[model samples]
Target: MAQLERFAETRTPASRVDDVVARMRALGDDWPPRDGVAVFNRVYLSVTEEVARRIHLGAFPDAHAAITLDVRFAERYLRAVDAAADGHRPPACWRPLFQYRRHPGVRPLQFALAGINAHIGHDLALALVDSCRTLGCEPADLEDEFDRVGDVLVSLEERIREELMPGPDLLQIGDPLTHLAGAWSLERARDGAWASARTLWALRDLPGVAQEFGERLDGAVGLVGRILLTPLPD
Candidate 1:
């Protein structure tokens, strides 16, 4: 808990992408290797670093929009971590990872996937809305940035599986982990997030409906995240 407090302190204002990357790195350093949140943080940190590098190299078509969207997207995850550390309930989409962060039966792959599920399925859409509001633009204007970020995540998903998957000899076809992993697709989640963002943006004028819609998305994503974190034998 004390360690979490220290890590939470590392979160600076998310005005700069480097600050967000640095804070996530601090979290990766503070958390033990097996801790579920730590595992997710490691994966997220890598994505952030790559995104930042691309932004630096002018790889994104609109670097400003890309940087804004990336930072906003990351802030949502960091806020959830801070909320958990402070003993508060995070967004519904994040509850499962926080609840199962240290369960012995949960594999590193499960942790990584659960985190990705929460972030991509739930946070990404809202982050799009956030970026739009901040940049005084619409979701359509940010679609390119969104796609670029999604591409980075999709590419990373393969590597994450390769690195976190159990040895092939032990991971037989009958393994529950194999079945569980096959059940969720990052690409599908990314598409859903984009749709959700568009819907949410359209509902911006209808605060009541928008709030309800966001809540439903959060709960639905949380359900998927919980399923992804299902424990299996070592």
Candidate 2:
């Protein structure tokens, strides 16, 4: 409890990103090469570092809001990490990546996609609302920034699919990875997240119902992540 509070106290928005980056790098260095979470961490860390660079360059219209959204978003994942480290269970959205980290059948592409699916699908929407509360504004006010951060994810998603995709020479149409890659789309996830942020904001007064809805969303995204991370045969 004391440790968590101190971490909470000392962590600025910039430092939070740094902490996550450093932690992800450490995990990658220490964990096995094929560990699912580590694989996803490497991809996410790169994107994060890019965002931090953009933030430094004053790339966004409202830098403060952008940094807040980015940090709060990263903190959700970090808290999950801290919880898991403390022997408390992480949120359902994060369970698959952690549970399947060592599964040999899951490829790095699947790992990366599953992590994106979990983070953007579940965490992004909530992070938007969180930033709204902290910034004292409506969801609409952050639309541009949301789309901006999302643009990065969308671009990264395309490159990841292109780079990690099995070659046409080696890939059969029946390949599960081929099918899985086509099945999930980051655009759809972004659309869904926008809708969720709107709905969650509307229901903010009804905390109980909002909490239930968030939990259900987390579970549904987790199920999809688990499917994406399913081990396949060579």
Considering every candidate listed, which one attains the maximal lDDT?
1
Model 2: per-residue Cα lDDT at residue 148 = 88
Candidate 2 lowest-lDDT run of ten: 1-10
Pairs with steric clashes in candidate 1: none
C-alpha-based local distance difference test score of model 2: 0.84
Per-residue lDDT, model 2, residue 94, is 92
lDDT of 2 by residue, 48-161 (tens): 888888887888888888888887777777777677778888999999988888887888889999999989999999999999998999999999889989888887887887
TM-score of each: 0.93, 0.91
List candidate 2 stretches off by more than 4 Å: 1-16
Each model's total of backbone clashes:
0, 0
